[model samples]
Target: MLYDIDKERSALVFIEFQNEWLSDEGILQRRVIKDLDAFRDAVRTGARIIESARSNGWTVVHAGLDLRDDPDYLLFNGGRDVLGLRGAIPRAGTWRDKGVERPAPFAPLRGEFVVAGRSGASVLKNSTLDPFLRNRRIDTLFLMGFATHVCVESSLREAHDMGYNAYLVEDACAAFERAQHEHVRKHVVHHFGAETNGAELIARMEG
Candidate 1:
């Protein structure tokens, strides 16, 4: 069933659309470049959805990854391997060899809020996002961004548990491998929230 999301009470969250993940020489390029065409298509879809969501008065939130502290858990633990096959999440700009310092196509614009402190996979943890949403009376969430099985999945799971009506914009997300992306969408994410696409979602927003 298609969830009837009220724009006044829903928020669209874009996770980790940073240079380290989506730029030309991004850290994941070595692993995901094989599906670069699919990834780029997803980005285009995401950008369109973002524009429509904003124009229609939906809350737009960019949940960015903050690796500024270079946390030890991400380095020594298995976080590095899971985040990037090359090992470890790169900080913005300093890792020039890894990628250029820039935001991806669907980057946040004026009046859109960029929620930071996402050292972990879930954007709500160690961050002000949850309260921010609650304060705005947002009861539903629409999600998309890099590595569908990682941050996107983690945040969606948390949002569902937090009692927010969560939906994953399937065509607006990307992963290192097509198989990984398909597996998570089929087996994992469906367990938490429903799957949606840009067109259907945009139609709902329009209606």
Candidate 2:
């Protein structure tokens, strides 16, 4: 079913669109991203969604992961290493020693919110995103970005628990493999929120 999205109380949240995930030479890209072409296509779709949101007066939030000062590398600890790669992944510099810059298409525009201090998968855990949305009176979220089964799914579950109306932009997200992406869309997304693509979402925003 299509949702009646309130432009004033809605936000388009982009998660983990940094160089470590989306760029050609991205550290994580080399480690996990299996289909580069498909991943790039999703990134382009996400960019289009952001443009539509901006034109329609919806809030745009960029949730980036910065692990530079994380003493514990929190993501790998506390049973969070679901991937089981643990020490072999994220490397030493990953998002730690390098800059957390996004690719050109995903860069934040003026008036858009860029959430910081997010070292984990879920954007709301250690970031100001929750408070920022609450302060602005926003309750609906359209989430898109890298690794559909990881960060995007994590945020969706948390958003549902927090009572926010969350929608997953299916085509605007990618995982290490196509099957992984399909798994969340088929079995997981509906449990937390509905699944919509960039085109349908843009049409709703424009309408």
Candidate 3:
């Protein structure tokens, strides 16, 4: 289910989809990877949301996560071989290289800020994202990206508190741990009123 908002005042926040997050060598249960597919679907769903919304003159902001860029933005696994953000996220001005290649349903006519990430927890961690979005008067935020329980959840909670109607694209987002995702979504996030999918959201935006 989706919680709709004013498309004119909403911004799609694309979180971490850099090269490092996609693990081609790590060994994990295949069942867990199924949930991780949300990361891919999010790219597809988020792109379409961005396209449709941008067609209606909404805002589109692409933000990524990086650890080596800044030390302060990271926590827990900043310098070690922590599985979270230990890979090459994405280089600035070249994020598209890591993109899934589906065209956005609502492409923006104006330029957007593709803010770089500093670490695993850096998407909304001590970043200029809040002020930047608020300065643009973005009241609702639709987000999809890597680490559903970490960056995605963190940003969702923060954006919600900051007065932005935030939603998590369930099928379009995922986490490093499926158990963690289930735990947070069913309990913690339930207390915060966040949406968890894109099907209905896309329809609402179209309507």
Which candidate number has the best lDDT? Answer: 2
After superposing candidate 3, which stretches have Cα over 4 Å from the reference?
1-4, 22-39, 67-110, 116-122
What is the per-residue lDDT of model 3 for residues 123-178, given as tens digits with 9 covering 90 to 100? 66567777787787877777777667777887878776767677776656776556
Please give the distance, in angstroms, between residue 196's alpha carbon in candidate 2 and its true position after superposition. 0.5
lDDT by residue (141-185, candidate 1, tens digit) is 888987788888888889988888888899998887788789888
lDDT of 2 by residue, 33-151 (tens): 99887798899898898888888887899998776667456667733544543454444446655447877767888999999766457888878999999999999998999889988
Per-candidate TM-score against the hidden true structure: 0.83, 0.88, 0.67
Q: Candidate 2 local accuracy as lDDT? A: 0.83
Which candidate achieves the best TM-score against the true structure? 2
Whole-model lDDT values for every prediction = 0.75, 0.83, 0.59
Ranking by lDDT: 2, 1, 3
lDDT of 3 at 175: 69
For model 3, the run of ten residues with the poorest summed lDDT = 87-96
